[model samples]
Every structure is written in C-alpha cells, then in structure tokens.
Target chain A: MIKTMKALIQREFWEHRGAFIKAPKIIGIVLLVTTLIAYITIRVTSAKVNGEAILQSGILELKDMSLENLILFWDGMFIGTSTLYFMVLFFVMYFFMLGSLYDDRKDGSILFWKSLPVSDAETVISKILTAILFVPIVYSLIYFVVLILLMIFYSIILLFHGLNPIELVWSPAQFIKGTLVMFSGTLIQAMWALPIYGWLMFCSAWFKKRPFIYSVIIPAIIAFSWYWFKVLTSLQFTNISVFKSPAVYLGHAMFPYSNDYMGFSGIQFNDDSEAQLSEILANLFASVQRMEILYGIIFAGILFSVSIWVRRYRNTT
Target chain B: MTQMITANNLSKSYGKFEALKNINLSIGKGKIVGLIGPNGAGKTTLLKAMLGLTKYTGDLEVMGVNPFKDRAKLMEDICFIADVAVLPKWISVDQVLDFVEQTHPKFSREKAEKFLKKTKLGKKQKVKEMSKGMIVQLHLSIVMAIEAKILVLDEPTLGLDIIYRKDFYDNLLNDYFDHERTIVITTHQVEEVEHILTDLLFIKDGEIVLDSDMEELTNQYFEVMVSNDNYDDAISFKPLSTRKIFGKHVMLFKNVNRGELEALGDVQRPGVADLFVALLREEEQS
Candidate 1:
C-alpha cells in the first residue's frame, strides 16, 4: 500500500513538474537577479553621488548596535525574502489542486489511470498529499537554498571590499531558527488551508465544464444571494457570515501564524519585535487546533471523500 | 472450471436514453470475443460496465469479482485499454514503467523494457513525442507485461492506419492471448478482427441482437450469391438482407438449410460484419 501511494504521489510530481519544480527555480532566479541589480544600483549611486561615506557609516553602525537589534536586522532581511516564497507556494498549490483531477479527464487519460490496480481513493489522496505535503516541502527547501545563496552573495561582496562579514552578517544569523520557522510555518499554512484545497479538488473531480469558473462562481453566487436576501429583509445589512466564512479560511490560509480561527485576528507581529521563535511556532500550531479549524477539517473530509467518489465515476469532462 | 465474466440482466440508461438494456453475458476463458456494434449501439457502454468504469443495474461479475464494487481488486487480474492515445501525453516511457512497477504487483519491468527495446522507443520519450502507433505500442507493451486473466479493449485502435491497426492485434494475439487469459474486444473494423475472433457479439439499439461463438455463427448464418434466375427462389426463403453485387443478388439467410443454399447459388459463410448488418436490419424491420 505504501509503495503504491509513493508511486501515485511521484506520478503527481511528474505530471506537474512545471508547477512544483520549475516554478520555484524560476522564482528563485528572478529574486536573486532582482536583489543583485538593486544592490549594484545602490552601490553605484552612492559612490557616484558622494554618498558612499553614508553607506559606509551604516555598516559601521551595525557593529555598535545591541545583540537584540542585530538579530532582528538579520531576521527581518531573511523573513522579508522568504515571504515571497510562501506566497507563491499558496498559489502554486491552489492551481495544482485545481487541475490535478480535471486535466487527466480532459485528455482522456483518466481511463488509463482507472485501468490500473490502484483505487480511486489512493489516487485522490495522493493528489491531496501532493498539494499539501510534497509541494510545500519542495518550495520550502528551495526557499532555504535561495536564502543561503543570498547570504553568500552578501559575504562575497563584503570580502571584495576587504571586510569581514562574520561580525555583522553571519554572527547574528538566524539560520537554524529561520529554517525551522519557514518549514514548519508552511505545513501549518497547508493545515489551515484544507477547506479551500478540498473545494479545489472537489471541483476538479466534480465539474464537467470549466471547473475553475464554476468553483469560484458558485460560491460567489451563494454569498451574493444570501447577502442581498438578508439586506432586503431587515432593511439593513447585519449578517455577513456567508461572505465572512470563506474569507476567514482564506485569510488564515494565506497568512500563516495568525490568531486562532475563533479569534479571527491577523498575524500578531508588533513594533517591539520581541516575539521569540517558540512563541510564533507555538501560536501557529495552537491556532489550528481550535474547534473552528476542527469543523473546517470535518467539512474538508466530506469534500475529499466526495472527490474520490466522483473520480471513480466521472471519467471525462 | 473456467473463470468467466457473467452478467445477469444488466441494464444501463442515461436519462431516458438506454445505453444497454438488460443484457446478459457469459464470456469464458481462452476466448477472443469481438463485440461489434454501430455508433451509440451500447458496445462501449457494456464494456465500460464490464471494466467497472460506469454504473449499471443488475448483477455483473468478472472473474468472480463484482467489477463496480471492487474494481481495483478485479483490476489485479483484469486489465483494459480504453482507447488509442488514452495514455497521458505528459508521461515519459521510463516514468510510466517505474510507476507501474511500484503500483502493480504483477507488472514485470524487465518484460516491458524488453518489448520496448525491440521497438525504436527511447526510455525518455514522452507520449506527446511519439506517433499514434508508438503510443499504442507502448501501451501494449505495459499491458502485455502484466499476466492478467481478462483483457478488455474498447476500440483500442480507432484512429490508427491500416498497418498499425493490423500490428496492434497481431501483437496482442501472438504475445498476449493464452488459455489462461480471456480477451474481449470491441471494434468497428470487423474484417481485421473477424478472422481472429473466437466468439462474436452483435449489439444494436441498446440490446444484444446476437451472441454466439464464431462456429455457431457459421452454422446459423449463410450468405449465397444467386443469379438473376435464382433470385425469385432465394427471395422465397426470406433472406435476412439482400444487397446487389456484380448484377447478382447476394442474400444473407438465417438458419437455412446449407444444402438448399448450395443448390440455389454459390453459398459461403457470412462474415461478422455482414451478419451484423443483416441482424441490425432485421431488428429495424421488426
């Protein structure tokens, strides 16, 4: 069973290598090039305009800063770059789940897949697992590698200037902490995004024509109809649960380490920057354990089962 | 004891349009059964139900397994080729092989690879890069490697040219078919498969018009070419269908005495294609 599942998931990776493998590499290259160009532009502008001394004084000032701010400086830069990756990961997974089941049916390959000894449940679960677990892991690992390469680029620039970067750059680096937060944070993101992912997969299997359009339009129509009904009945708009329900899930899913689903608050980062790694990690794991998330998970389970059932019978668009 | 596919009053309908109407079938081991039908004649629908790809009423069993209830378990011993070019265009030759090796316990990687080596297909060739014939060859290679008990093919060579179409069935018969295996094929190119089919099934109007072995068909159906003088006598016996060829009346008769047919004209056994048309026309007249 395990071997079958591994093959099925590997099949998913092979089928969607563009989204899983190439997308991350392209994102990494664009980010690295943009960073390099920006740094070079800043250096040339500063040196040509006689502002090099000001830039020099900035690096010298980092030496005099306290350990706390120095660590914050390193973390702020690391997290800033890593933020784009997690953002792209969400969209990559969204589209991956959307097409995972539908593409095969459109191309008539669903018959080929169903001809095998693997059950529909295993195939659908492999798709879910690919969206939730495998893609996130691949994106996170690439993000980490890009971060390391960016830091190494900085080290080379410092060495070119005949200065030791260890005192300012590597000394207060949050390598382990940043790696832990990004990898663990992406998993939490996927865990919170289950309901939305479930809807995508369900639509992928269920809809005969334009599953993407129907997946979005059907929910939009429901929310619109319910809002207008409430507004017209009471002569004032009061109940927005229909609109807010999916918003809450999407919000928490899009932004990781937010408040509990019940609380409906956004990320807890403050100006003081006193938050510890453990505090944020604990908050993320704790927030998804709430009853609200539990309900969402139950809803997701129902959709996933229906997705498998639909895949069993719906061999074509 | 032969493991046979048995269907009891099997019926399938899409809305008001019945695709298959209470069709009962019993296909036994070592027989190559050709399910010949016209468009929307329920041939594909019946094959789908047999392969567990669709829902139907009544009981259907393949090799003692309820196909719809336990398709994956049944697929362990039964395999199907739904159509030509159904294999994913994005999948590479090597990747699909690796996947089948991992997923199907009965799949033999070495056998598939050996068959592949005999062709010009490189390991890294994707289905998209290969021609229509190559894709069919690759699909056949993987299917042949698995020692399945029952093989179901639904128009397996629909779009292929004459050479590829002939090659497709030739490989299937020579390398795949055996006493331990049962093969059920549905095709419109009846002439190619008529020589190979051991049993013949003719379905039309969502019902099985005729189901009998090839030998039984030879006994039941006789086609004769009668001259203009014998045409009136041939018509008296009520031929199932009459088509004019070479200014002679070529008639298809059902269950007529062979000695009388020989006396009337030059008698010959009818092909499944001719028998099918005669049967379909008979259904229409009734």
Candidate 2:
C-alpha cells in the first residue's frame, strides 16, 4: 500500500511540476527582484536628498537598537516573507487540488490509468494526501530557498554598511524557531483548510466540465438562497450567518493566522513595547480553536468519500 | 483448459437502450478471441464489463473473480489497452516506466527498457512530443513488460497507418503471446487479425450473432467461386450471400458440402471480415 501510494503521489508531482516546482521558483525570483529594486530606489531617492548622511544615520540607528529589538525586527521580516510564501502556496494548492482529479478525465487518460492494478480509492486518496501533506512540505522547502537567499542578501547589505549582521540578524533564534512555527502552523492550516480541499476534489471528480465554476457557484447559490429565505420569512436582515461562515473559512485560507507573530495577538498589545517571544508562540498556538478544526475534518471526510465513489464510475468528462 | 473469462446471461442497459443483451461466453486459456462487431454492437460494452469498467446485471467473472467487485485484485492478472494513444500526453517515457515499476509487482523495468531501446523513443520524450504511432509504441512497450495472464484490447490500433498496425500484431505474436496466456481483442480491421485469432465472436445490435473457433468457422462456412455456366445451379443451393467478381460468382454458405462446391468451380475459406458481413446480413434478413 505504501509503495503504491508513493508512486501515485510521485505521479502527481510529475504531472503538476509547473504549479508545485516552477511556480515557487518563479515566485522566489519575482520576490527577490522586486525587493532589490525597491531597496535600491529607496536608497537612491534618500541619498539624492541628503547624500551619505541619511545612509549613515540609518546604520547608526541599527547600531543603537538593542538585540531584543533587532530580533523583533528579524521576526517581522521572517513572518512577512513567510506570509507571502504561504499565501502563494494556498493559491497554488487551491487550483492544484481543483484540477487534480478532473484533468485526466477531461483528456481521456483515465482509461489508461484505470487499466492498471491501482484501485479508485487509492487514486483519489493519493490526490487528497498530496494536497494535505506533500504540497505543503514541498512548498516549504522551496520557500526556504527564498528565505535563505533573502537572509543572505540582507546580511550582505548590512556588512556593506559596516554593521555586524551576525548580531543583528543571522544569530537570532527566530530563524530556526520561525521555521518550526511555520511547520506547525501549516499542519494546523491544512486541517483548517480541509473542507475546501475536499469540496474541490469532490467537484473535480463529479463535474463533467468547468469544475472550478461549479465548485464556486454551488456554494454561492446555497448561501444566497439561505440569505433570501431568512429575509423573506423572519425579516432579520441584521444577523447574517450564511456568508460569514464560508467567508471565514476562505479568509483563514488566505491568511497564515496560526503562525507566531503573524497573528494579531502574537504582536505586542502595547505601543512601543518589546514583544516577548514566548508569549507570541503561546498566542499562535492558542488561536487555533479545536472544535472548528474537528468539524472541518469531519466535513472533509464526507466530501472525500463521495469523491472516491464518483471517481470509480466517472471515467471521462 | 481453465476458463479465463465467463459471462452467463450478462446484460447491460443504458437508459432504454440495451448495450449488451444476454451475452454468454467462456473464453479459455491460450486463445486469442477476436470480438468483431459494427458500430453500436455492444463490443465495447462487453469489454467494459470484462474489465470491470461498467455495471451490468447477471453473472460475469474474469479469472474467477467478480470484476466490478474486486477489480484491483483482478487487474493483477489482467491487462488491457483501452484505446490507442490514451496515455497522458504530459508524462515522459521514463516517468511511465518508473510509475508502472513501482505500482505493478509483476512489471519488469528491464523488459520495458529493452523494448524502448529498439525504438527511437528517448527516456525524456513526453507523449505530447511524439506522433500518434510513437505513443502507441510507448503504450505497447509498457503492456509488453507486464506479466499478465489475460490481456484485453479494444481497438488498440484504430488510427494507425499500415506499417504500425502490422508491427503491432507482429510484436504481439512473436514477443508477447504464450500458451499460458489468453488475449481478447476487438478491432474494425478484421482482415489483419484474421490469422492471429483463435476464435471469433460477431456482435451486432447488442447481441452475439455468431461465436465459434477459427477452425470450426472455416469448416462450417465455405466460399465457392463458380463460372457463368454453374452460377444458377450454385444460386439454387441457397447460399447466405453472393457477389460477382471477374465475371465469376462468389457465394458463401454455412455447412455446405465441400465436394459438391468443388464441382461448381473452386472452394475457399472465407475471411473473418467476409464471414462477419455475411452473418450480419443473414441475421438481418431473417
């Protein structure tokens, strides 16, 4: 079973190399280039206004910052970069899961795949597992390359300014600790995002064509109908629950809210006060409410079972 | 001999149209059965049932396993090429081998590599980059590598030129077929597979009109070429169908006297394609 699943997942990676591998590399290049251009433009504009004094004062301010503040600045940089990566990861995974089960059927390759010894359940589960586990880990590895490159680039800029980057940036515990936080955060986010993945996969297997439009339109119609029904019957237009629920689930997906320092509570509550790292981690872990994750998982299980059953019969679009 | 496939009163319907109606067949080991049928003849539907691809009523078993219920286990001993050029176009040749090698326990990567070496296919060549014929070649290479006991092919060579189609059968005959294995094939070009098939099945309009071995089929159905002098007397024999070629009459008959037909002019065995047409025409007229 493990062997077959490994091969099946490997097949998924091979088929989706554009989204999983090339997209991240492209995102990294774009992020790097834009950041470099932005920094150079700011340096040129500020230098044109005041020459070397403005640049020298910035270094002096960095030199005067306490190690605690430097670490906090470093944490901010890590979280900011991580948020970009996670946001792109979510979008990439969204379309990836959306088309995963449907593409083969559309192109008529499902006939070839069905001729093999693998079962329908194995095929669909491999795709779900790819979305939940494989894609996140692979995205992180590529994301790490971008993160390290940015770190080195910043360290070089600090060294050019004659400041010790080791003390100010590289030596901080936030680098390793931030990664651990991202890992745990993503796993939690996977659970949080399960219903979306399951729904997309079920739509992929079930719909004959245009699965994306169907996946969106089905829920939209349901939510709209509920809204109209409530307004007509009870006239309670103030408290709307239908749209808020889906929007919250989709809202959680676009934001990496479970990562330390990314959450609002993880940041400092008081103005001009140093944020404690321990408190940030605690807030990050605490923000993940257990009951919602449990419900999302149960909802995901039901959706996925239907997807597998549909896949067994629906070989072509 | 052990039966590789058995279907008893098997029937499948799609809405009001019955795709297969009361198909009863027992294909045994070491036989290459050619399922010859015209369009909408339930040939594909029967193949689907045997492969566990479609739902049908009544009893159907392949290798003693219920196909739809235990398809994964049944697929271990069964292999099929559902159609030509159905492999995913985005997949590279090396990935195909790597994938099948991992998932299939009976697959021999070495055998696939050996077959691929003889062709111009490179390890990195994706299916999209290849011509239609090359894609079929790649598919055949994979099928040849697996040690499956029963192989089912539904129009495996539908759109190929003459050379590729001939090469397909040549490879299957010389390299793939063995006494321990059974093969079932359906194709439009019956003449090409006539000599290769051990048995013949003619399905038309959701019914198996004729089913027999090649030897029995030839012996039962005979074709006679009669000169102008013997044409009327040959017509009196109530032959299934007749046509004129080169100022001589050719008539096909089932279970006719061989010596008496020799006296008319010349006796010959009709090809599967001829038999298919004659049988369908005979059934339709009645």
Candidate 3:
C-alpha cells in the first residue's frame, strides 16, 4: 500500500509540477525583484535628502527601539509577506484540487491510470495529500527562500550606508524563528482547510462539467438558501455556514503577532514592552477549537470517501 | 485450459438504455479473441465490465477474482490499452517509464527501454510532441514490457494510419503474444485482426450474436455464389443473409454442409468482415 501510494504521489507531482513547484518559484522571484526595486527606490530617495545623515539616524533609531518593538516589526513583516504568498497559494490549490480528477477524465487519461495496479482510493487520497500537504510545504519552502533573499538584499542596502549588516537586519529579523512559525502556521492552515479541499476534490471527481461552479457556487447557494429559510421560517438550524467555516477559521488563525500590530501597513509598539513569543504561540494554537478540528476531520473524511467512491464507479464515457 | 474471464448472466444498464443484457462468456488463456460488433453493440461495455471499469449485475469474474471488487489485484496480472491516445499528453516518455516501474510490480524498465530504443521517440519528449504513430508505439512499448497474463485492447490503433495499424498488430503478435498470455481485442476493422484472432465473438444490440473459434466459425459458416437460375434453388437451403454482387447472388449460410452448398456456383469460407455484416443483417431482419 505504501509503495503504491508513493508512486501515486509521485505521479501527482509529475502532473502538477507547474502548480506545486514552478508557480511558487516564480512567485518567489517576483517578490525578490519587487523587494530589490523598492530598496533601490528608497536608497535613491534617501540619497537626495542627505543620505549620510538619514542612514545614521535610521541606524540610531533601530538601536534605540525596544526588543518588543523590534520583534513586532519583524513579525508584522513576516505576516505581510505570508499574506500575499498564501493568497496566491490559495488560488493555486483551489484550481488544482478542482481540476485534478476532472482533467484526467476529460483527456481520457483516467483509463490509463486505472489500468495500473493502483486502486481508486489510493489515487484519490494521493491527490488529496498533494493538495493539502505537498503544495503548502512547497509554497513554504519558496517563501523561506524569498525571505532569506530579502534579508540579504536589505543587508546589502544597510552595508552601503555604513551600518552593521548582522545587527541591523539579520539578528533583529529573527529569521530562524520566523521560518519555523511560517512552516507550523502553514500546517495548521492546511488542517483548518481540509473540508474545503475535500469538497473540491469531490466536485472534481463527480461533476462532468464546470467543476469550479459546482464546487463553489453549489455551496454558496446552499448557504444562501439556509439563510433565507431561517429568516422566513424563524428557525435556526445552525449559526455557522459550512461554506464560510474555512475562511472564518483562517481569518482567526492567521497573524499570530500582537493585536496592536493588526493593521496591514502601520506598526505601533510600546517602548517598555518585552517580546511575547510564547504568548503569540499560545494565541495561534488557541485560535482553533478542539471540537472544530474534530468536526473538520469528520467532514473531510466523509467527503473524501465519497470522492473515492465516485471515482470508482463513475464511468468515463 | 484456464478460463481468463467468465461472465454469466452479466447485465449492465444506463438509465433506461440497456448497454449489456445477460452476457455469458468464457474466454480461455492463450487465445487471441476478436470481439466484433457495430456501434452500440455492447462490445466496449463488455470490455469495460471485464476490466472492472463499470458496475454490472450478476456474476462476473476475471482471472478467478471478482473484478469489480478486486480490480487493483486483478490489474497486477492484467494490462489493457483502451485507446492509442489515452496516455497523458503532458508526461514525458521517461516519466512514463519511471511511473510504471514504480507502480507495476511486473513492469520491466529495461525491457521497455529496449523496445523504445528501436523508436525515434526521445526520452525527454512529452507525449504531446510525438506523432499519433509514435504515441501508439510508446504505449505499446510500455504495455509489452509488463509481464501480464491477460491483455485487452479496445480499438488500440484507432485514428492511426494503415502502416501504424499493421505495425501494431505485427508487433503484438511477434513481441508480445505467447502461449502463456491471452489477448482480447475489439476493433471496427475486422479484416485487420481476422488473421490474428483464434476466436471470434459477435455482439449486436446488447447480446452475443455469435461466438466461436476461428476454425469452427469457418467450418460452420460458408458463403456460396449462385447464378440467376440457381438462386431459387440456393434459397431453399435458408441462407442467413444474401446480397447481389455482379449479377450473381451471394448467400451466407450457418451450419450448412459444404458438400450440399458446393452444388452452387462457388462456395468458400466467408471473410470475418463479411460474416459480421451478414450476422448483423440477420439480426436486424429477424
């Protein structure tokens, strides 16, 4: 079973290299180039306005900032970068899961795959694994590489202005800790989004046409109908909408930084405060309820099993 | 002889349309069987049932296992090329080799590579880059490399040129077929596979119309050409079908003695294609 699963996963990688690997790498390159352009623009603008004095004052301010404020600034930066990266990752994963099984049947390649010794369950599970686990890991790795490049680029800019590269950029940035946080956060996000992935996969396997509409719009219609029903009948089935659970959990789980740094651009930190690394970790873990996690797993299991069953019996004619 | 497939009262329906109705068949090992039929004749549906690609009613078994319940285990010893174009177009030739090697316990990468060495297909070339003939060649190379007991082909050479079609059968007979393996093939061009098939099955409208060995089929069914005067006399023997050709009446009779039919103008074994058309004509008339 393990051997077959390994091959199946490898097959997914072969088919979706563009979505899983190339797209992330390209996103990384784009982010790096954007950072370089921004840095050069800042340098030119600073040079026009008494560059030496501005550089000295910036370094002096960095040195005077409290440790809590420094950590908050770096946390906000990490969160900001990841927000952009995850937005792209979300679309990549959504379209990929929606099309993974449908495309095989569309192109008549499912017959070839089914002719092998692998079972339908194995094939479907392998795709689910690829969508939920493999893609996030690949995206995280690219994000890590981009983060390192950005730090290096910033260090170069600091060195040009006679500032200590390690002290100004590397040490205060908390590179190692920030990367660990990103990896862990991605895994948590995958867990929170399992039901959404499962729904998309089921749509992919079951729908004959327009799987995107079936995966998204069907749920939207259901949620809207339930809301209308509740309004008219005055009966509350449940407060939570199944279609919006993942988004709700995701909004709550992301940005483990302190509440004071909630805004996207602005960073405000108290001068006398200390870095609350443990507290931030606690808050991140606490965001997801134990019961919600249990229900999500159950929902995912049911949808995935249905997806496998659909793949097994649905004829590709 | 071991029966590679057994279908007893196996039926399949799509909504109100019956795709296969009460199919009963036993295909033995080492025989190249040709399943011939017209469109919507349940040939592909039967193949799909045998390959466990669809659900069916009644008892059906392939290689002594319930194919629908144990498709993965059955596929370990069975291989099929449903069409020449079923391979994913995005995968490169080398990736195909690697994937099959990893998934199929019976697949031999070395043998597949050996077969590929004779072709112009490059290892790095994706299937989309190859011509239709090359793609068929590549698929054949992969299929032949697997050590399987039963091999099924459903129009495996469809959309290919005549040269490629002939080459496909030639390679199948020369490089793949042996006494240890059984082949079941379905094709529209009956004449092309007639020479290779040891057994013949004719299906019409979701039922088996004719099933016989090649030698037995020839012995049982004979066509006779009668002149204008002898046509009335020949019609007394009740030929299954008759058609006029060059001002002579050509009639196909099933299970009629050759000695009896020899009194006509000319008597000979009917070609498989002609036999198929005659059989379907008989079905429609009946």
Candidate 4:
C-alpha cells in the first residue's frame, strides 16, 4: 500500500508541475515587481515628506512595544502581502485542480488514471493533498524570499536618507517568526476552506455540465436550502429550538466569532502591561483546540467518499 | 482450469429499463476472447460490471474475487481501459512514464520507453499537444508496460485510422499477449480481430446469445452455396439463415454433415463479421 501510494503521489506531482511549478514563477515575477513598487513607494514618500517626527517619537520602539502596535504592524505587512500573493496563489493551485483533474474527466483523461493499478480514493486524495499542502508551502517560501528582498530595499532607502536606524533595521528572528506565522495561518485558512476543495472534486466527478458554474451554484443552492429549511422548521414547529442553538447559527458565517468574544472578557477590560507570555500562549492553544477542525475533516471525508463512489460507478460510455 | 470470470444470473437495470438481463458466463485464462455486439448491446456494461465499475445483481468474479466488492484486490491482476482515452493532460510523456513505473509493481519503464521511442510521440510532448491517435498510442504503450494477467480493452481502437488500427492489434498480439495473459476485447470491428480471437461471445440487448470456442463454432457451422434448383433441398438442412445471390442460394447451417453440405454446391467459412451480423439480424427478427 505504501509503495502504491508513493507512486500515486509521484504521478500527481508530475501531472501538476506545469500549473504548480511553472505558473508560480510567473506569479512570483508579478509579486516581486509589486513588492518592489510598494518598497519604493514608502521610500520615495518618506524622503519627500521627511516623516522623521513620526519615526522618532519612540513610536518605532524596538525595546518597548505595545500589543496594539504589534498587531497593526503585523496586519499591515502580512495581510497586504498575503492578499496579493493568495490571489495568485489560489489560481495557480486551484486552476490545476480544476483543469488537470476536472478537465481530465470531461476530456476523457480519467480513462488513463482509472486504467492503472490505482484506486479511485487514492487518486482523489492525492489531488486534495497537492492543493492543500504541497502547492501552498512551496509558493509561500518563494513569497517569503521576495518579501525579505523588498524589506531590505526599504531599509536601504531609510539608511541612505540618514533617518533613525532603529525603525528601519529588522531582526532576522522577527522575520523568521513572521514567516512562520504566515505559513501556519495560511495553512489554517486552507483547512477552513477544505469543503470547497472537496466540493470541487465532487463536482468534477458528478457533473457533465459546465463544472465551474456547478462548483459555485451547487454550494449556493445547498446553503440556501438549508437556511430556508431551518426557517420553515422554526415557523412550523414553533419551538425555534434549532435556530436557538449557538452551534448551528454560529457555524455559517465565514469566520468564527467565539474566539473574539472570549478575548473580550471582563478581565481584558483592565489593560495590564505585565501579563505573562505563557498565559497568552495558553489562551492561543485553547483557541486552536476549540477551532472546529473536526467539522472540516468530516466534511472533507463525506465529499471524498461521494466523489470516489461516483467515479467508481459512473457510466463512462 | 480456474475460472477468471463467472457471471451467474446477473442482471443490470437503469431506472425502468433493463440494460442486461440474466447473463451467465464463465471465462478462464489462456485464451483471447472477443466480445462482439451491436450498439446498445450491453458489451460495455458487462465489462464494467466485471471490473466493478457498474453495479449488478448476482455473482461475478475475476480471479476468484467479486469484481465489485474486491475491486482493489482484483485490480492487482486485472487492468481495464475504457473506450475513451483518459490521460492527465498537463504532464509530459517522460513524467507519465516515471509515474507509471513507480506506481505499478509490474510496470517496466524501460519497455515503455522502447515502445514510445518507436512511435511518433516523444518524451517531451504533452498529452494535450498530441493528436488523438498519438494519445491512443501513448495510452497503449503505458498499459502494455504493465504485466497484467487479465486485460480488458473496451473499444481500444475506436478512433484510429485503418493503418493505426491494424498496427494496434498487431502490436497487441505480438508484444503483449501470450498464454499466460487472458485478453477480452469488446469491439465492433470484428473482421480485424477475427484472426486472433480464440473464443467469440455475441451479446444482444445485454444478454449473451452465443458463447463458444472458435474451433467448435467453426466446426459446428458452415455456409453452403446451392443452385437455385436445389434451394428447397438446402431448406431441408434447417440452416441458420439463407441469402439469395445471383442465380444461387447461400445458406448458413449448424451441425450439418460435411458430405451433405458438399452435395449442395460449395461450402465456405463465414467470416466473424458476417456471423455477427447474421446473429444480430436473427435477434432483430425474433
């Protein structure tokens, strides 16, 4: 089984190299240019306006830091870079998932895969693993390197102008920490959106119609139906019990609010400067544990099962 | 000999319609079997059912395991290539070869490389960039590399030109097939496959109407040509069918004496295509 799976993974990687590897390089060029532009923008604007007052108010404090400032800086750099990268990232990854996989079925490429010694389950899971794990990790590393180069250029500009060196200088440890956080958070985002991946695979297997449209429309119909069914059930039964359940209502939105609500407790009202790092780590761990990861797993498993079943029994002729 | 495939009282239905009704067959190893049938005659469904790609009731086995329930285990010995070509389009030929080499225990990448080099397709060409015939050749090369016991090919040469089709079958016979391998090919091109087929199966509306070894079928049957004056005398032989020619009668009979057949005018062997058409015509009449 291990040997077979190894071969299967190799096959998946081979088939996706064009989309996964070559396409990323093209996008990386765009990312590099954009990062350069942003770096130059900050340098030119700062030189023109001489925003030295803003830099030297101890506001760029390296020794003394506030949580709000840290978050602001982190969100500013990370989210801005991440959003641009992900736009290219998801397309590079998901396009192959769409074209190589779903297009193969439509164009009779499934015959080649199905004719081999591999099973349907092995084939579909390899696709999911490629989309979620392999593609993102490699692309993120490339993006990280480009970001580092851009930061150095930004720092050079500041040093050339004889501004305060404290704000411009970067700790390598901080860079490493920020990259690690980006990698972990992006993976979490992928995890949260697994149902979408599974849904795509299932759509590939199940429909002969335009797969892209079905991929979007089918999910919308299902969610709408569920919502309407809940509404009708609540009206007819008069108990309103299902709607009253926090788990049922809370799960629908894009991001979970439970963690934010936990962070806003009464003790947080009194802002204490000396809260222990260990305590903060404990809260973060608790939040990670509470994340509804299992629901994603179960959703993925269900969709995977359906996709496998369909591929196995479908009338190819 | 152990039976490699057995379908007993098997039936398949789609919605309100019956696609295959009560099929019973037992096929074993060491013979090349030809599955010939008209359009919508359930040839593909039977193959799918045997591979567990389609659901059916009753018993069916390939290499002592039920094909539907034990598909993964059965796949170790059996390989199926459906009518349509299904190669992943993004990969190069070299990558595809490497992938197949790693996945299948019995795959020989060296053999595949040799075969590929002989063909017009090259290692650098992607599947999407290649022509349909080249794609078929590539698919055939990869499948031929896998040393499987039971090879089920459904319309393997469907879209190829005449030369490629002939070459496809010739290569299949020469390089890939032997006594250790059992090949069951489902095709409408019966005349091309007639030379190599050891056994013949005729399916009509999802049921096996004729299943027999080639030697027995040939020996049991003869097509006799008789003069117009002796047409009624030829009628006494109870032939399968008779067609009127230019001032003569050509008739097909089963289990008739050689001398009696010769006493007419001339007795000749009917090609597999003729026999298949006659049998299908017989079904339509009934």
DockQ of each: 0.72, 0.70, 0.77, 0.44
Residues B1-286 of candidate 3 have per-residue lDDT tens digits of 9998999999999899999999999999999999998899898989999988888999998988998889888999999999887999999999999989989999999999999998899999999999989999999999999999999999998999999999999999999999899999999988899999999999988999888998998889998998999888899999988889999999999887799899887888889998988878877777
Better of 2 and 3 by lDDT: 2
Give Cα distance to truth, residue B173, candidate 1, Å.
1.1
Which number leads on DockQ? 3
| Better lDDT candidate (3, 4) | 3
- Candidate 3 residues A1-317, lDDT tens each? 88888888888888888888988788778877886776566667778898765543433345556666767666657767776666677678778889877998998988999899988888888888887787778888988998888778767766775768777677778777667666766666676667777888889988899999888788778878877777668665565444355445444333323232221332234553344343445544754544666787789899999988888877445
**What order do you get sorting by TM-score, best first?**
2, 1, 3, 4
Colliding pairs, model 1: none
Fraction of native Cα contacts reproduced by each candidate: 0.80, 0.71, 0.82, 0.67
C-alpha TM-scores of all predictions: 0.93, 0.95, 0.90, 0.81
Please list the residue runs of candidate 3 whose C-alpha ends up more than 4 Å from where it truly belongs after superposition: A45-70, A233-247, A250-280, A315-317, B225-238, B242-249, B260-266
Off by over 4 Å in 1: A51-68, A229-242, A260-268, A274-279, A313-317, B1-3
Best by TM-score: 2
lDDT head-to-head 1 vs 2, winner:
1
- Clashing pairs for model 3 are none
lDDT of 1 by residue, A1-317 (tens): 99999999999889888888998889888877886787677677777888747455433445567778878877776666656676788888888888978988888998888889999999988988887888889988988897788778777777777767786678877777777777887887888789989999999888877988988998899889988988888767777766666776776677666564432564566566845555566776776676767888888999999998888866632
Name the TM-score of candidate 1. Answer: 0.93
In terms of docking quality, model 1 is: medium
State the fraction of real interface contacts model 3 keeps: 0.82
Clashing residue pair totals per candidate (backbone < 3 A): 0, 0, 0, 5
In terms of DockQ, which candidate is stronger, 2 or 4?
2
User: What interface RMSD do all candidates show, one decimal each?
Assistant: 1.2, 1.3, 1.0, 2.3
lDDT of 4 by residue, B76-187 (tens): 6777777645676677898888777766778888888888888988789998898767877887887788889999989988888888899888888999998888999999
